[model samples]
Target: MPPLSRPPRETRALFRNAGAALPTRHAALLERCVERRLRGPAQVLSGHHNTNHVLRLGLLPAVLVGAVPFARLKYRVPRETVEVVPRIWPREWDVLRVVCRFLPEVPRCLAVLGDNHSLHVYRGGTVLSDRGPHGRIGEGLMRQFAAFFARTAGIPAGELPPLPEDWPADGDSDGFLRRLVRFTEERVHRPHRPRFGTLFDAVGIPEDAMARFLRGLHPLTPRPFALLHTDVHRANVVVRRNRIAVIDWELALFGDPLHDLATHLVRMGYDKEEQARMTALWAEAMTRAGRAELTAALHDDLGAYLAFEYAQSVYPDVLRAALALPPHATADDFHAAAHRIGHALSRAREPLRLVDVPPEPHLIDALRHWHDAQNNPATPR
Candidate 1:
């Protein structure tokens, strides 16, 4: 075991031989996060970095370790896509403390580490992904599950009391939408442009169109806002023998409730039939829970929210696509990247009015150019 206060360089060398040690920096971060806890002894059950460094820390009755500041862009043909790399370690302790108070479905938080990491005690069940790709537990379970959150509906103003800091600080619907667009622009899109500028140009994601979409989406009927686990996908949902638990609070936000459902539908791998059924179930649950106002315009407005999801997703999707191609990428690698990026652009076509997506060959050339530039010794990045 590494010492708790070990310098990161020494820590990296200590774990250099370990299989779980990804890169020196990632290994040091992971070891440091674990060192703060499990003082006696610990095991790294699994390691992954989606939005954070996730390590399942034990074999049975496991606790998950999530450490922030890990790399993202770890992708493909049209099979799957990476959405927004959510804000890492976003006041999750405070958010989870609030969510567990109102929603019984959330997993209990075991510990909040000093380093902005969290330990989520395993809820002792399987995530829905284990069942199948679509991960259906039936509409009865869905409606029952949806109704469990009915209380989120009808909470009077100031009843739940805002977080010490609301994410956007402006609770209006328009501000919330604008904030999401800004998150994509500032955090995901702009940061990597210098390194991957050509890829951005080739994908031709319409920045002005995204801005226009946000403006157009603002005036629609506003839904009552509630706390949303904005990243509610199949993996985040744990289905136990008795109860269900939603994990991962880092991306939770206070926003239109319908956005939550839209996120779930997109991320949960639901088929079209299941999507409709689940939507009905969710709406009934919200309406019965006294959130009729929120669901009132969902029929007319759900498309916009779903569109926002895809639109915001484009930033991360493109970044990940470019990052997937290695410096010495083969023809096959470029071909796959073209397919993947093409799929993402096509998904956003209708919503963002991406009228002119470049052909596959141009996309391939752009990605190769960007990858080579990054790896070239003479290139000044």
Candidate 2:
């Protein structure tokens, strides 16, 4: 028999929706932004909301195209002219410049392609997430992270790069706190509008509770601030040639040094035993660095930051849970989303004044409605 004829090539779609729980755009502009920096052809590897469209060059180098904060909006809420403008991302680039200068366990930035993309000497490494670190929660991994943060803490503020224009000019710690609270309110909580508000209402978060919680959190002592990676979960750490390399500096912030420890303790998925060990290791390291004062109230104050983290997380968590459902979602999808969102709301209940976490069935209806609305062109914002 004659050989079967090969099919004709079909053009790829600019946007991909299938198999993706969240809506994602190809970002041809960003791809071109990276390609301009390369000498030859580069093949796209992967693309997602939190991550850039990764492209692999012929042999070694890889390019990353970044996405704006919450770029993948589930609900297209109307925004004022002021709200449409983007914040300065040069801060992250400047942060990488500082980090690579001091920390050896980070990818070397090759070029800043633009405000939203950068080229780095891609350290061919395995992301630790694939290794079941979250499952094992070993002491060795905790120690490694502890030491990394300690070394980062030692990088003097004077030696660090200058702050961006929008950052508090006076360097007031309270100013930074207020900024964070505003960010939580305006960026995370506000963007989804009526749905986000409705979710909070159903959960029973009091109108003024979040504000009161922010005010109640006052630092008891004076301690110097340090740079923090701010999102140090397993996915951000890569094991390259047996050395751990941290990536994704877009969320870097300067604040209470102890806040970094708190963020790590919560975000790293450490169990009770591992959390205790990690806390002790962090305290010991800071104590050795002559900053014992920084952690003086960690046991007491860390709770406040952890609460803030959980509270800030609820918006994304709920949206993500809802988005995880497919078109005409099955009962199993509803159950799964309910479990995840309910857990998030429970963690944030105290800080957000959530009187009660809603039951699974209610979440199912809320999520199903929201999911369906995302597909409707004329859905109310």
Those runs of model 2 whose alpha carbons end farther than 4 Å from true positions after fitting are 1-91, 164-175, 203-209, 215-219, 324-327, 376-381
The C-alpha stretches of model 1 lying farther than 4 A from their native spots are: 1-89, 134-137, 148-171, 215-218, 326-332, 377-381
Estimate the TM-score for candidate 2: 0.74
Error of 1 at 76 (Å): 27
lDDT of 2 by residue, 1-381 (tens): 421221112211211111111112333443453455344443333312233434443211111122122121110111122121123343455666667767866755443433334444455578888787567556666777877887787777775566667875433545655676787677666666565565555544555555856766776344567777777888778886667877766567776766677778777787778778888998888888677766766787677777777777776677667656888788888789888888888878777766687787887777766666666747653
Evaluated with TM-score, which candidate comes out highest?
2
Report the poorest 10 consecutive residues by lDDT, candidate 1. Answer: 70-79
- TM per candidate comes to 0.71, 0.74
Candidate 1 local lDDT, 1-381, one digit each (tens): 633322245443442221112445544554465554345433332212323223334221121122112211111001133336444334555565556666656654444444444444345577666777565667666775576545544444354335535454423555666667777767666776665666677668664656756655645565667766677676666788846677766566667777788887777767788878888888888777767777867777777778888777776767777777776889999899888788778777777777777889988877777777778857543
**What are the clashing pairs of model 1?**
none
- Cα displacement (angstroms), candidate 1, residue 101, comes to 2.7
